[model samples]
Target: MGAPVEIRGLSYAYGSGDLARPVLREVGLAVGPGEIVLLTGPSGSGKTTLLTLIGALRAMQAGSCRVLGQELAGAKEAQRVLLRRRIGFIFQQHNLLGFLTARQNVAMALELDPGTDEAGRLARAGRMLEAVGLGDRTESKPAQLSGGQRQRVAVARALAGDPGLILADEPTAALDRQSGGEVVRLLRELAKQRGVPILLVTHDPRILDIADRIVAMEDGRILPTEKAEPAPAA
Candidate 1:
């Protein structure tokens, strides 16, 4: 298969005419399978805008954005919706339901998969929670867990559907240093294990070690990327 994500001469703007404010300018990027790419820059550099375009959360405005081998430049809303289901998304907030247990929150994501029965969904959700080191806390509610644990549940929920690509936006911004470290490490491990390509936007320098490449953005354009040294053997 081709790279999960590819972009060329991509640009995006908001408003109309004189009110229009461009957020991405001639951006080009690609995320290969099994690769972990970190997008870093100052606020309003367009990191999140790029993620949204790649995730199909926003309609493409200019240039080509191919995701999972499908071009998005002129795709319909229905197509965008379909493309979205194939992508896993994580954000700064956990966005978990306070009423649901950890396992239930993850199982909810699987409900979108038409092939799985209720029992099968729960089983897979439990397994994913376990993979995130939350097996013992699967029965706990969001309020009953720490911020890190809630974020772990969110991660499990995102990965439960076996998505082709993962897009994360400032996933570590809300946690303590230790919690953020643990969360990003878990994400790195899971993405590597599943051979899933991840495009993560972050401002945290502490977790840069987890990336294979770091792409910087400035004033809506991408700067040259720097390859990160391979992680030391465990």
Candidate 2:
């Protein structure tokens, strides 16, 4: 298979005319399967913008961006939906339904994949939660779980689909150092064992050691080194 994500001369701007503000400028990067690339940059450096573009959550504007070999620039909604099925995302917010148990929260991810039977989805969800050290809390509601545990549930949900690529934005920012460390370890193991590419946007230096490569960004452009420590993507 080709690289899970490839971008060349990609650029993006917000608004139009007088309000147009560039968020990404000629960003070029490629992520090979089984590798974890950490993207670190100050706020508004286009890190999240790039992730959103690659995730097909937003319409692509300039240059070329290919995920799993499908060109995404100006892709239609159906095409974007088709492409997104093969990708997983873990964002800062868990976004779990309060009424759902952890297991149910994770199993719901299978809704996107109609091929998976209910039994199979639960089985896979259980295994994934176990992988992230949340096996014992499978039936707990979001309110019953700790911040770290909830995030792990989010991780399990994102990975249960056997996605080919993972895009994590500040996956560890809300957790303590130890919890953050565990999350990164789980992510690293998943990327390596499944041969899935990961592009994580994080300012957490604690997990930087887990990355195979580090790409810095600044002012909507990738930089040689991070210019300043910026807050999590807004």
Best model number under TM-score: 1
The regions of model 1 sitting more than 4 angstroms off are: none
Error of 1 at 218 (Å): 0.3
Candidate 2 residue pairs that clash: none
Choose the strongest candidate by lDDT.
1
lDDT per model, in order?
Answer: 0.93, 0.88
Q: Name model 2 segments beyond 4 Å from true.
A: 225-234
Measured with C-alpha atoms, the lDDT of residue 126 in candidate 2 is 90
Which residue pairs in model 1 clash with each other?
none
Question: What is candidate 2's CA lDDT for residue 169?
Answer: 98
